[model samples]
Target: MTHETRSSRRNFLAASSGLVAAAAMPPALAQTAPFLITSATDVLLPKGKAQRVVICGGGWGGLNAAKQLRQLAPQLEVVVLERNPVFFSCPMSNKWLVGQVDTNFLTFDYLKVSEKYGYRFIQTEILAVERDRKRVVTAAGSLDYDYLILSPGIRYNYEAWFGNDRRAAEATRARFPAAYVPNAEHFRLKQAIEDFKGGEIVMTLPPPPQRCPPSPYERACLLAWHLKTKKIKGHITILDHKDGIRPIGLGFRQAFEELYKDQITYVPNAQVKEVDPFNQRIKTAAGDFKFDHAILMAPHQAGDLAWKAGVIGKNAEGKPTGWSGVDPLFLNLRDDRDVYVIGDAVGIVSPQFLFYPKAGHVANRHAKIVARYIAERAAGREPAYSLPDNLCYMWVSADPQQAINVQFDYKIGDFQDKGKVILQTQIDDNERRPELIVEDFRWFGYMREDLFG
Candidate 1:
């Protein structure tokens, strides 16, 4: 798409003041607009060479945010800090673990995205965030910014499982890889699966609020499919902490029963009490289970940068919440307005009713909102606040080419004794069509192009 086309799409939403009340808008208007504007306010422009936006983490949220910010305000300097030189997508990476697709299909060069989008990309680890000084200290150097955007993703909560023994946690991670992070873990798990001759393969699911809600189930289904197709003599066991699969419970339940009932065993509400990697045994509240091979999806928390910066901590109720508190409408830090938090790092405190899932598509949508907000503010105009929508698809089978989809819309509601934002979800699972599999590739392509191309 041309620069003009991209700007026009963003401007269309900016020009429509009535889009703020999108819940009551006409169907025609709602269908065309991508977000619902919530509020607007004028602000004085600061004196500088050009407003600078320093974005941390070059994944979906940060990349899209930098791209859109440059498109909206060509004069502004957009800098991205990412530790990884190459970008690997977590979405659809389960296919790679199951040997359905090559790793190259899910990896991209950061230099290409930087060159195409005209943004400065730095491959350096962020050491600390000096919020009061408006600068971030990195392993390379420190950089100041007028506005900071954090999409630092998440970190595994290993302490929750292994206490203060870091070595034990690392050893356990090496034994049973969690491929959810989209890196070497993918290959580790894939090799283990390929080398397995027979016996039982175990996979554990962490509590909710993880990056992708449907991912564990998707992995289980695909692994089961792999076992049956390859004629491997093995049974796959899924241990979930929740009472049952959720968000798309009905769809996954049907898949387990109708297709892989014999090859897969699902045990829900099986909370892990102890993990004995030395003996290849997992002791859970329900019972102790042994496995020939295992994959443990550890509990998740915000990246350490957020915690070190004091951006995420206990809430008013003194409960430890491992995310940064942000204004739901604009995604800016509630305590420090100049800093914005997006993607999986966004946290919700008590009595606040915002329910945005930590998914790639949701993060992509957040990038647009933050980009618009910064662009309008720099131009001495008040940008209307907006809420993002989510579109997600999960693959169930490769041979049969079947998939499931979910779409969600959010709207601001009255702040009575309820959450401030309301969610309306629509799911398509009645018929598992092969066309959805085709659309799955199309969706990934469109998203990548939208952010990087």
Candidate 2:
């Protein structure tokens, strides 16, 4: 949690619209500028006074890399550039939206992490990346990196799929907000729930490759639990874009049917096309749903930042080849060994058993391995990434006790055993063990500190 003062660096001069100096550098070549080299792994420090490692994004993946790199490679200078002063944790946000927990509990300060972790924190937007020069461009200045780790998370594909209603959807986000980030969305959704006298409430799930796959269902169930407890006479319906719940369909079904069936209605293989705010109805592939409140978990893609930066290449299909590639090296343009893509940004191969969707836990784990690998290559050593394990808990209701768990262990290269089933647990009303609730809180706390805090 140690904070470092921001250092001045030259701006990345983009030679042309698309190309840069770093991207043009050969992998074997080394820069003459200032750099640091570690003893054990030969991690290259930023050139000159300190070896610099620049990490983009301050969420789970970025923060984890910053913390770990500062600890392991103490000599290397670490800098984290984030656009926000405070980060909102989407993990425990559902509780806040339902009036069960305070919004303050879901918000965390980056100062603690910056002050203690020896990471220079800058609050700014990354304008672009000069791959050939191995530099990052921001409104403030440009940053040269011995190695770079990119983990900007996911973005809503509102423009493509949401279409002309994008603005209206964003406007309605205040009351029937997606509650995705838990700041604006949380407050708006909270207000909507408070004003509700009791009617139909719908929460829709989009297609795959979203930040949190089980979130919509978990959110729907949590809201249903809240309404039932408040004596609100309303039915909670979850309109899913996919045919089933997710990779662990059986576990999801068991949780809904056995625990929340009374208060919730599950609709799968549904696609919501539009929302008539005036009529209070949702138009979808299945049919039209009239509800008092509607929550659309819109489709997503790699953050717009990536698309804007020209980092995402398009195929013949006209779809931006962000992480949709079937290869682990998707979007990995390693010019001069300067740039490294991890987390939701990079399209890693997914095993047929369970699709590798984006999640905070997975992103955090991915960042560590990528950070270590980048650090190794900086010191003139070969880079190697480790296997990543994913763990996520879906809340069944606001009871804080009922939940479902799915765990995965993935190997880096082998697509067949990429994801090995670890465990899946369902928590029923009768099985609401107090110890598990305590465990869940403890896990979330560790996760918060490791990621956002």
Candidate 3:
């Protein structure tokens, strides 16, 4: 089939209501088989002639983008570069920490994901992004790409908390496991919690723009639940840098007040001034607090690759912003159309209208949008970009199996001249429900299948 005819056929199939409905079916049905890519266009590359796409980071965003790209345009050559061989999801990992789920359930094989989607998977650390040459340099070798999607994720900003003492910062991180990222830290935190005989367990929430806005609160709640169930004589203390646990502030506040009032103590605006890992204490603006166990959610910034690429630059006051600048419409770098930034790495455009929570659900939705845009561009068409949405669920307790849900919607303004972006947010009723917990698992299952099945 001619390229145009092939594109038309694929578009028709994608738009079919039946196919759309099938795509929305539960994960149990969809996971039974590989998602069929029904493009008649054969993978007829004439000696390295296909457009090459490189996806950096194999998290929810990059993996989903690769899968969607292959589903939309299988003829194109796609590659995924991930630092780690195994993909451990940050979403719902708190459950693993609280003993709700096993660690194996949070991990997946990158090789399987790549094989299932027919993409080259390379486990290598990215050294640099050669934007002018449209190539990425890894520890192993340099890779050229026609298009690059960066979902490099976030890196903890230790300097912000520890100042000039790099060694002290590293020591602090080692001593207190954040467990925000999917790593050995989760197990460390779990062990610490388990070993705690009594006294206080202090968990600090960093300032805004952290991944999974509601996660720290969720962790606090679940940990309190664990302690309560175990009859451990311990009080869980939450120190928040912000005014309160936000995005789902009201809901979380109510949860703390009603359920774990005796076991949980929440102190807001408790910014960290210094951390004494040796003494097992944190000096914050609110006050100096000592703990038998601690999990410090340190400040976070865009991945180091972004800073190395010069995409993350100083602001007007000559302070590092620690995020990549991308076009609000396409998530493409302002200076380089060939490069796109998504997920937590994307800099805030406008906090009022364009800001999105740094969450896995947001990243998954971003992957779809970027993948569709790239597919349309490859087909020589102006794509109809879809408005990205974010859906997040936070569990409140384990025994009762209750959770809270939040959704965010965005749209461009009606006036073409103004080009203002608009945002709308909704939180499910403050009352947590067992059904929401079931739906949370269903949501996670669908997301997993969408990216790796």
Candidate 4:
């Protein structure tokens, strides 16, 4: 705790960033200087008298965890570390892209969530997580945590599709964005879709275990809808890896055929082979396709922070899922009880059995359960196990405001063992309907109020 030790830590952190006494560091890196400040220094605000619980990433799961943790355990010092200044909701973002709603509907105050919910919000890029030291290294400095919850979200796996072709990957992302990630890609993709005058619009879908299984198809429907409604004289060609629509395949296929049959072309079993972004061309398993504009989705992995924290686990096959390795039912790391993970970054326990979908709804449910367990453990009580209920709705039509939904109910199987659990699913009226669209928006509204309040 001496000044000498603090100075050493700062010097060490700066050196780690390859910049010692970096007075001339770049503007972005200079903010935090990537310095590792000792925990003794109250850099993340005055530590106060409460035991600190640090939640990484300010997305759906992290925000929900902060909200519930503050409600259940008023004494804990909850600090949310996020890189972004404002929260942009990805759940209803598709609606915003198609002009069904405005930007205000999807944007929320990130710091306000902290202010209203009695937590400190720190805006800093997470550099590393020294689990052995029970501290998180941020660009600003480092802070120790009594309990840590990581919900850092997903990272794109461009390697699967683009491989070592970094140039092609960068070009594709720059011109034709997938908009799957909740970042600048959203805005860029929106502008691309609007600026389309006419021609073949190409879209690609990745394999299973990706975030939001039904999202690609839902977006296809919306894109087709935009073309039809606007009379843009454009056609959409969807090269899907799966056989048909996913999660709710039957219903989505019905929508595609009945609604946008002429304007949209659905190609199945079309795995990606090669991508030539400069030429607006792609070769798939099904066939070769070229387009005037495109939306591309690379496979996804857990966020970099999750990997940096070293919590990524494997599936039943013992293959890396690029997500947090944790006790399936408890949502805590296998090796450390004080650390937990939720949201899309959570590793799939068993692909054959029942795995939680990487969706915002599932993450919200995950936050509530994780909050309760943390609170119970803090109170010196053995926490009871509870499962998350996940429901996701996709809007298929902006004209009639029609949508479809899927619900998953998770429970322990009779033969369930440690680190493995079973899931039960239900689809309500499992088809596109006008009534479900209202329910979808209503659910979105209620969730926003609960989270952003």
Candidate 5:
């Protein structure tokens, strides 16, 4: 097919109704499965009024579960707790930031979702989770539930690395903001690019156990492409914490050599010790350096709520770790009897890398399992939880027509292995799969719609 024809086809695949078809397909075909490993039969489904599911965070996991619960169990009451009224999608958003896609399309309103899904939307932050009482206390009110799903997502640890350099954050917010959180920072970052005359533009990668692991490199590459194409001068520096690169490090190397070339510089094992916003200098393990603009993607965690609730695993000294334990289906680690945890807030990593990176796709898939389980329980039946297969796609627009993907599956309790099966597809420099593009569009759209549509 012609390029235009192929683009059209992919767009069609990504349209609203296309999600049902895409979701029905196996991960190999969809190239977008999250945590689809081994399937679990209906063994531990809960029954009747015994299940009151209160999902926290209106992001992918909680929102997806809320939608599924309403669809599968119409009589069961579901409440979604989200601090934001609209969700600004992180996937495909980079395209928008680079002026490829419009910014408006990336924004989805939860009010529409509240109307369609018939679920309660409490715009409040969760202060604490009383698991013993089966209750959650928020800034707005206290909610009681039989089952709880926490998907509050990852929180950046600025104090650990930044120290007294709080101004570094402000400087970043004033310069190349880390739009990873999707708000004013996102737009501000875009504007910084628009205003840049181009000097040393630096982007740092966070340590592991952070959200969207591959995203930093993707962002750096895309930004470099934009700078090169726009003929902006100066070096595009990527400072990483580890001695090596990221998850699909080899593939990324291929991508870097083929695409970014000398436009981007790689600094390995160069951890940023501290950043001086006053002088715009970043002190790293290697040494100190100054930049015209910088973005520090810091290490992240599950935040204070998990610690206050005594849910997240504690260290030998009883300090809170990043996340709580979760099963294959993302149920709570402490008491899988009735709770579910999803997204970066979850601690269980599939040995098969099925649910790696904690991306939006993985969160959505976990939502389906949690919702299905909740629905089954409401009907006085046992709910089964299954593993999710994940297909992660990276769009490097230097060669805008193509995309690269990594696919994997997970088995419960096998988070350390890559399972026996791993699937991957590289769309090549010029090859275009309409279905893949369609899957991308549909994936983000459905994710937005299903969550905050």
Candidate 6:
């Protein structure tokens, strides 16, 4: 991000500043299961007389969109359909895993946020979207919608690693759980980390454009830190699928060499060829390896809801891109004004947004920008377009409380670029600084307070 871009981003963040508050973690409102109402539905789902907007997914994107819509158009009934009753923060979860933060720090109640912001939230599985009939077919029932915003986030594409072997994929998911998906996965991974009476913990990274580009490396650093501090008889091996530490390479590389050289092994471009999860072994392009424990991050795709919604786009070769076909700038379906896909599930073919990193900060900004467009269109006004800017933070050490930061700013391209956005990145040497972590806390805390406080 340039100086000007950074200032603008700061202003936007400052605008959302509210009294920081974290809701008390609640027990499961009902039995935690699929296709079931986890929250109390005895009161009945809100049947608003006005135009209804259903925001799918209760994570960062959907929740922010709900908040904005209620404020922008109070007459519009905003309903968010999410599978989980409690909201979990994937952003700060690495901190949680290493005991720097508690589970309470990562969990928030959806009902409390819904009530506080005057939006309706239903904890029911979203089966599919009936776009032609203008309704959502869910476990609860068919829900008619005036407008639908899909923001269900990312899901692992296990097929990339496991091929057609369902059992292998499931076994890998069960044994070497990747914690990127939130809540349960995080719990499983955390337990695995704690239980490691270890020799070598193997960690793998998925290819680019996945949610939070820095997550795997960050976790590796934290895991190494944990082993170093706890005097655990182990080291970490990062089987990176990419060429190198991306976006903020120098920072991570410096840390790897200076701080964790004795405890971490960095391997680049280790394209996974085959997996033998049952035998606790994997074959990658570089070599074959067996592990005492493994954290396997499979390739990513749009969440199931996006596929079920029939919004996923196809490439020029007719292969499914595993992301929604939506207007690059406005985030609305080009063919259907009534449908929009936000967050990590959204994709574009243009040069600017193609392979845009599916991170939460961008999703939050993207949702709000789309909310304005939706509100303006609802008022029968022509909507304007704007690009998004974001910041990503990673913790390389818990002991010194130091971290690395990367900022991205974007602007509408010139005449030759055909209205697409151009990226401006600002990460000089990617130094690990203590202040960066503080800003990270504020970023997470402010977002929590803005919607739930």
The best candidate in terms of lDDT: 4
TM-score of candidate 2 against the unseen true structure: 0.80
Q: For each candidate, how many residue pairs have backbone atoms clashing (under 3 Å)? A: 3, 28, 0, 1, 16, 2
TM of each candidate vs. truth: 0.86, 0.80, 0.87, 0.88, 0.79, 0.88
Model 6: pairs clashing at backbone N, Cα or C within 3 Å: 1-425, 1-426
Evaluate model 6: give its lDDT: 0.80
Candidate 3: worst 10 consecutive residues by lDDT?
A: 38-47
Superposed Cα deviation of residue 38, candidate 4 (Å): 13
Clashing pairs in 1: 20-37, 38-385, 353-419
How do the residues 54-80 of candidate 5 rate in per-residue lDDT, one tens digit apiece?
888877677788888878876666678
lDDT (Cα, tens digit) per residue for candidate 1, span 369-409: 99999999889899888877877777778888788777777
* Candidate 4 backbone clash number: 1
Candidate 2's C-alpha runs over 4 A off are 1-48, 164-166, 313-318, 322-336, 351-355, 412-435
lDDT tens digits, residue span 136-226, model 3: 7777556678999999888898888778888877777777889876687777777887788988889888887788888899988998888
TM-score of 4: 0.88
lDDT (Cα, 0-100) at 440 in candidate 6: 85
Residues forming the 10-long window of minimal summed lDDT in candidate 2: 1-10
* Residue ranges of candidate 4 with Cα displaced over 4 Å: 1-48, 314-319, 351-354, 415-420
Question: What's the C-alpha lDDT at position 130 in model 3?
Answer: 77
Better of 2 and 3 by lDDT: 3
Clashes of 1: 3
Write one digit per residue (lDDT tens) for candidate 2, span 172-207: 555566766536666777788788888888877877
Which 10-residue span in candidate 4 carries the lowest summed lDDT?
A: 25-34
Model 3 lDDT, full chain set: 0.80
Local distance difference test, each candidate: 0.78, 0.65, 0.80, 0.82, 0.67, 0.80
After the best TM-score superposition of candidate 2, give how far the Cα of residue 212 lies from its true spot, in angstroms: 1.4
Question: Which ten residues in a row are the worst by lDDT in model 1?
Answer: 37-46
Candidate with the larger TM-score of 3 and 5: 3
